[model samples]
Target: MRRSIAVCTLALVTAVGCGKTEPTTPAAPASGSTSAAKPMHPAAATAMQFLQASAAGDLSKATGLLTPVAVEQLNKQGMTIAPLNVESPKFIMTRFLVTEENEAAVEFAMQFQIEGEQQEFHGCCVMKNIGADWRLAGVIIDPGNGMEPVVQNYEQELSPPTTNPANTVANPAGGQVPQTAQSPDVPQQR
Candidate 1:
């Protein structure tokens, strides 16, 4: 009887621990001073939410929590996808390399499977305190690979530079031009 009780108890605990949803409380309205000045232990909950969202391919909900720029960039790619047949995630965040930063960012590292392939995805999420609300700001994906974000050379994958046209070219010293139509066309230079 005691063994049966123990088995039941263990099963209950496992069920509760595995499929948990974080309570989403709408953050207070944006009042410059009253915002929660910090995010705590978000690595675990946040990671879980991400996995749930990804597994379900809930793009609309997931994108809402992400930076507009990232969404645009991905959509530009042919990867408008929500992979299926993925199993529920087993939260391994407690084993992740997590670091708490200021009120805006938290760093996390974890190993997980995607498409049955295992890879470690670690990144810094830049959160913004907007109107007493703590919404995700942006995420810089870091694989801990020490390599910069991979820039795919595919034409369909490229987005035209968002950089200001005038800012991209370097000006010569003394602000003199080599007679190229570049920057020299500006009457201000004449």
Candidate 2:
């Protein structure tokens, strides 16, 4: 599980890190500024709204923007819609595109001050079509510090292996536990 999470986090970081960001410039006066901020895509906007609601601890509003599966996943994970441990959180969208016929992926970087220290983390939210609306289906955030990936929302279903452990050898040192090798294709359990 740790390896898989690391690979996924690396992939997302690479993808978002590869994008070219514009250099910041001094803002013009509101009355004189002609260029308005570009509007977010409808699906991305929904994602942003969900993030905001979640950070604000607005459970009803946050859950309203999530799929039933996501809600159930959060319940299983013992996670609640609560305020984060950071202050002045700012979100910067890195990518927003349709990933499939009825799915969209929104990649973002969240910057905030944690105990007077500035920190940033990256994550992605997947939105799926539900009739005429798009709802959050999955969310994965890497909060660094070697912490476990925060899979706060739904993704693929998880189930225990149906059979006993495979590919193990007895320890030569008379240890009771057998030594086992992990396959790259298999995700390890926490």
RMSD of each: 17.3, 10.4
- Candidate 2 local lDDT, 42-93, one digit each (tens): 6776777777766766778988888777677667867656556454566666
| Local accuracy of candidate 1 as per-residue lDDT tens digits, 53-141 | 55567866655554444456567775542432344433232122211222233333435578888765444334433344333433334
Give the number of the best model, judged by TM-score. Answer: 2
Each prediction's whole-model lDDT (CA):
0.40, 0.62
RMSD of 2: 10.4
Q: Which segments of candidate 2 are over 4 A away from where they belong?
A: 1-36, 72-79, 145-148, 155-190
Best by lDDT: 2
Query: Deviation in angstroms for 62 in model 1?
Result: 1.3
- Candidate 1 segments whose C-alpha is farther than 4 A from its true place: 1-52, 66-103, 114-117, 150-190
Summing lDDT over every window of 10 consecutive residues in candidate 2, give the lowest-scoring window. 24-33
Show pairs that collide, candidate 1.
29-131, 30-131, 30-132
* TM-score for all models, in order of appearance: 0.38, 0.60
Q: Lowest-scoring 10 consecutive residues by lDDT in candidate 1? A: 93-102
